[model samples]
Target chain A: MEPDTQNGGGMAKLGIWLVVLLLIIGGIVVYGKRGEDTKKASVKEPIKIGFIGPLTGDLANIGANTKAAVEIGVDDINSAGGIGGRTLEVVYEDSQCTPAKSTSAANKLISVDKVAAILGDTCSSATLAIAPIVEQAKVPLISYASTAAKVSDAGDFIFRTVPSDVLQSSFAAKYAVEKLAKKKVAIIFVNNDWGLGLSKGFSEAFKAGGGEAVFSEGIDATSKDARSLLSKIKAIKADILYLLVMPGQAEIVIKQAQELSLKISIFGADPLEDMTVWNNAGKAGEGVMFTTIGTSPSDDFKAKMKAKVGSDEIIYSGPFAYDGLKILGKVIGEVGTDGTAIKDALYKVSYEGGVSSPKIEFDQNGDPKEAGYAIKIVKNGKPVVVK
Target chain B: MDIVPQLIANSIIAGSIYTILALGFNLSFSTGKFIDMGYGVMMVIGGYAVFYLSKILGLPLPVGILLGLVISGLVSYLAYTVVYKPLRARKASGAVLLIASLGVLTALQAVIAILFTSQFQTLSGLLSGNRVFEIFGGAITAVQLTTLALGIFLFVILAVILKYTMCGKAVTAISDDEEVSKIVGINTEKIIGSVFFISGVIGGLGGMLIGFDTGIEPIMGLPWLLSAVTAVIIGGIGNVYGSIAGGFLLAFAENFGIWQIPGEWKSAITFGILILFLLFRPRGLFPK
Candidate 1:
């Protein structure tokens, strides 16, 4: 074989370098043109809503759905003569539900995006992660569906569209007793502040409602063995199972319960509304039920969502997100993006057609108070309006 | 005595799953001298395979298990050949490899989410079919029994291959010193590739077993990796038998830790113990 020559400043190297530079320039021109179109449409200077969630992790489904819903909401608001005569724009950052990511996003939303009022950072820990930043920055932060009681209690600057676990669990236990008519229950909750907190509220409420949480079991969010968890449930012999799971394990408990041959009804929080769980559960999910704030705003609202966003993929929290923007837009209209004025104005803005829940009034703790819930059953593989 | 029998049974069930991960994790790690964050992603692929087959395709659970194993194993091999081989050829450092693995991890994780949509799903096999055995104060399910059986089976096969097979000797040679083994008669390239395949198989099997027990979620991999790593380290890395010991110890610490204080503190306790070991005895409980 002939001896191979090293790259002695060959023309081939120069040709390759020239192509690389051309590709970079081409990419920039394409992106810049798209940016210009958006700017011409006046989207660049629109009223901004900063949002955060785990856009690409275990919490992706819930976050993606919420993002989609908010996009629809903003589009609807903007097209309808815009909010406060200003087009609404939403900027999103992925928190991945890590505290570090949440803090960075929260700071960026305040200091960088300069959003008047912010939304989301789904996980309770994440919301708590950014709580101090939002509070100190005086940016009125509205979390759509996080329900750890600590969220509303974090401070006055933090307001949530979803009811706290305090209300959700009491309402859940009430449904179990009054609706499902089951006395003994198995509480299988993900082991976290969120799970433990919901379990506590449900336990207290269930006992108060003349029922007992026979066996309350905890599994780490990363647990792999539902057999042990199910065996313990079988051991308890609960008449009904209350699973407080993240989107990760919600379907697991449902199917594993089928394996254990325990035919008890499974009730969970709104996180169970995830399409993955619904699709995974399939026929097994026929009798399953969970609590949400309320049903879709109206048939027309849903039809609009179906046309604008993908309907079958809609989760419970999206409607609430739309309501969040509408509510914030009103606040901005009244107070003109001043955090103090917006924060004070939020308590006074009363709007009908609030998504997911009933009424929009902040309780002493900044959680929505006295909201009716939506409890639907999966009939024929679809969530039928079962009152 | 009631708790003891149950604890022993529970420990074995948990240990079996962690063993699959630890054994596979240590094997490639010892020889290649690089960690594969993508191993967890391989487990997710295995899990999704089983779920799609058994649930959607309506295939039998056994077929699903085979499919999951084959799919995940092939994916792992292809990933190494495509993404890792070039990096290793260029003599990339360990940190660069870690970052590359993370990239693979992120991309694989995204693909799984896009396909399954981040829902918790399970394998539908009668292997767990509501069969209950009341053993003492605690009752163990059929699936738990099967998991124990699977663990023992893998351990036995691992022993046979490692102690009595030629490829096993080659693996040992490489683990001892990859550079020295390459200079010797052993084909280091072939051995390294085979090690990755076997490790991938272990990961796939782990997903199947865990899928039967709990449920399979994309995010499920991190916790499994953490447990397996803890077991490997505590039992002595690269020591397969020692990992089984480490698995039990870790499970026991997690479960019974709740007994002393509020049960929610189990994780705090588990991590606290992990930190203690790290600070005082990072060599692990059964250091090789």
Candidate 2:
């Protein structure tokens, strides 16, 4: 048999079928045209705001929380008739907490989502990566937590709602020197931009405060054993411990230090404020002190959050998220959908109160310029204001 | 002096972990003649499995461990069967297999993230209870001591089997020459399968120990994998005893390296040694 003959009798029937297919496609096109005209009359066009953060990875919690915060802001605005009378919508892009990915996410949010603004990013590295993306797109991006000093100064288009590392680092070191009343301190930080940035600032502030940093060491961010780290800190006979690991490694160092009976005052940066400390270290974490960007959780914030979320999962994380959204909304209303205008609005704006903290404002770099770190100590299973 | 014992003890402990992972990594690479990057993902999957069973589902720790082991072992076996087996049949290059392993790594990490979320989770409450023990000069938790014992136990069991058992001899023969082992009337497929299962077991155990010590997270696989690989490469690839010695050496060196310098330089020291070795003695301390 010929090779073409093997195609079967069905192949010859295709000429008539092609004509029928075109007719069917033409009918559908007519229906779509009619439907498009009708829908334009009824609903208010939604203003799409893009959100970029790590929804997956080691830093998913902060990423997820920051993303949610942006959404909450949009939700509040849309519920109240939105900006320029258009409903607000958020398009989320996952950054994986890397600058490269964050930049890609920024581009997609701008080109694909066609969003007027963006909210993101818990990591400073990601902030650095996307700074150019947002600037080129001229889309105002208000970050919930990226606090690296370079992030805010990236361009006029970027702004940060969270407090800067500068304040937190200084506050953390100061807590060790003054509050813990320790004259000699040893620092153990993770090796990274976040760790390095904080280390430089903390050392300067700590030395100025008249405390000697006998040792300032960094371990791999993912180090399996920090006992060697603890040993180095212990050898210095440091009266205070300055640690800057993420929640997981922090617990290891804390628990190991406790086991060794190396009872020194523990001072930490903001990431240490995660619940993992109490969850993993338990009683061993008692008396630890740390400084953070957010306003302390007040009773009023708790009550309001409970009323808003009613979900046990988001209770702790929701307010900061909600605050992030509201800030974005307020900026949008004042800035008139312009990225630069919104960035400018973040500079002078003040939040009356929000879930994670009270009264939010940013300096020129989009960082909470005047934002001071609030020092808190663990006592009786709760973080009490120490200063 | 205060830091010396601490650093030594810490390095030994850290080395034990690296050895656990490195031993398994080499086991697969040696026999298969290709380094499977998926070895690290197995650890994350195992940890996430235990976390789900024990913490989320509220099962007993031992049961969770068993569940984790079974799930992880089965997954690795399937990975070999489905992905590696097909690729090998196609006469795929090692680079191709490496790419497949990266894909598996991504998909597995995504699954873990979906199931457990991206947050670092620790097994606490009944999963982790109070048990602290002290030694002269420095101290470690009962959990840490238990991990050390398990590491030693697994090493002995593996060494004994590899040396004495017929299947073990087949594995060695395969590592030496796959074609020769198959021509000698040994079922290479069966032998490779068994090796994969053993490697998976070691990986699962490594994951469990890490859960007991440092917390577990989906993103932890690579860096942990890197450390183990560092030990394996430094000690001499496929040399079990060398891997063991390499692990301890690295741990000890890392601990001792940070003595006069700040603690943060600890990673830099480990990475620097890895680089120096790669440059100067790439064949490692005990090259095969």
Candidate 3:
């Protein structure tokens, strides 16, 4: 009776193995069939593009805002039936606002992802780091926020929706000298591409306009103590203090400057458009004037961004980022995904009624033509546009 | 340079903060006999605790501060028990313990970032207003002056306690020889645990004061840690007074060093001194 039971158990085990084998065979066949289906569906494959930004670092706030705006651009493109029935998709990579990381991210996007075009690298250093690579690959890259003046000569394939610091620096320098009647300016900037570019340009412009640059110094990005620098500037008796620092450091500099009783007119670049800096600085940031890229989002775009980000306050580059992706879509629609073709077509592609600017047109340097600038002053704990 | 007075004031303020940091780190280092790299994050923990409790939860300033100190102390004690103690029982090498402390530092910093969203915050905003003080033709803030006083006060209190108290004797014995200390009827584990708690409190105080003076970030501890470690080594690693002297010396070198150069070279000047000390004066300026 025991032997008979054992034989019955063996027979049951054999039956179970047979069923499992059959199921494995069936799964492979089903999976292979789905794979073929995907191949057939390639006709409707999405248009691929790459995006690079500082997703998780000191500059992450800017990255988050620009990334959301780009996502909105992708949504807008798809909802409008996409470009020639193919949906738009973006491959996002975090550069962390460093040149080395940006280079690696660009390489991955170009080689691994094989994206048709690239949209970002929010920091000027990151953009410059990848410019030669994109230029070599003949890939057209457009920047949404980088404003460093040297970006104008980075590469022919490089383009930016925002104007270069050359324009903004001259604008600010003129305003400081002519409008504010400030003769002596002390320039302290973060020792990075953005700060270096803006500070040097502003100093040159100010000096050329018959204003004296009493002192110009560079500090590390993570520096929290500015007492010595402030004291030196104060001793030199500068009437205007132009700060070219990241938003976080801006608060420290302003507060420390206030504590030392070095009361002077404080000015900054576009990065100060952030309300977080003013809020952190509190009353210390009062009357701090800064220059930012001039562009107004349309009501429709503003409403979309509000619903998308759940806040009416869009980042300063939000409209520019949306316009950048949309312009790429338009260019890709006119010309196929060929790199040089896209590069050539971007110059001819004149987009009007865009959210960032009223009209977007690329010039000889691949920069937007005649981009305007706006001056904002911190008042009562908020940045109010004065010009 | 007419900026001499301000430079001196800046050095003193920065030096005091570093002195406080060095004192906390040396206490834990002496007792544990291993570099507690994780000691730096205690400052971040304390600063963030107060920021959340007082700034966000609307708790009273003193209550928030006391709770913050306790929280940091508890975290340090837990780290010692759950990580360092177990590793020490297994006879881990100094290198192994150092790496473990690094892991602790990275993990705690990430946790803080996740909770606070990595935004820089200032506790000074909660104060009604900031008062400026003048000294010898140099302007100093009320916060800076208080930070200076606290650093000196902590140094004296620690010096007295370590020289006279029974707990201090036990810690010194353990630091000298842990096995010998255990065989001599000393409760080594309990004493080390308490030492870690004290270290955390001192580190937390430094952090809170810096937050009020400048601001706070999860990454803030690393730079401060680098400075303190350099101070500890240069001041004679186990000597309490060495840390104070080393802290002030490094600050003076850094502040005055940048007088003729660009401010961007400040860190370069600091690490340069550190490397010189490591090569020429490994036992430090005040070697025991």
Task: Give the CA lDDT, 0 to 100, for residue A331 in model 1.
Answer: 80
Per-residue lDDT tens digits for candidate 3, residues A1-387, read: 999999999999999999999999999999899789868977788889999987766666778788888998999899999988898999999997889999999999998878899987888988999999999998999999898888989998999998888888889999999999999999999988888888888989999899998898999988998888898898889999999998779999999998888989999988887667887999899999999888788888888777877876677777888899999999999887899999999988899988888899999898999688888998898888995
**Candidates 2 and 3, the one with greater lDDT:** 3
Off by over 4 Å in 3: A1-41, A133-138
**Would you list the rank order by DockQ, best first?**
2, 3, 1
Best of the two (1, 3) by TM-score: 3
When summed lDDT is taken over every stretch of 10 residues in candidate 2 chain B, the lowest stretch is B123-132
* Most accurate candidate by TM-score: 3
Residues A191-214, candidate 2: write the lDDT tens digits: 777777888888888999998877
| Model 1: per-residue Cα lDDT over A1-387, one tens digit each | 233333544667888999999999999999899778767975336777799887876678778778887887787778787766777788999897777898999899898778988898788888888888888989998888778988977888898887778888899899899887889988888876788889999989999989988888787676544545565566557898888887666766676566546668888887877766766565667788888666556766677667755665567667767777788987887678789889898877786766565567777677777666678777887666565
Native contacts retained, all candidates in order: 0.21, 0.88, 0.61
Pairs that clash in candidate 1 = A226-B213, A226-B214, A293-A356, A294-A356
Best by DockQ: 2
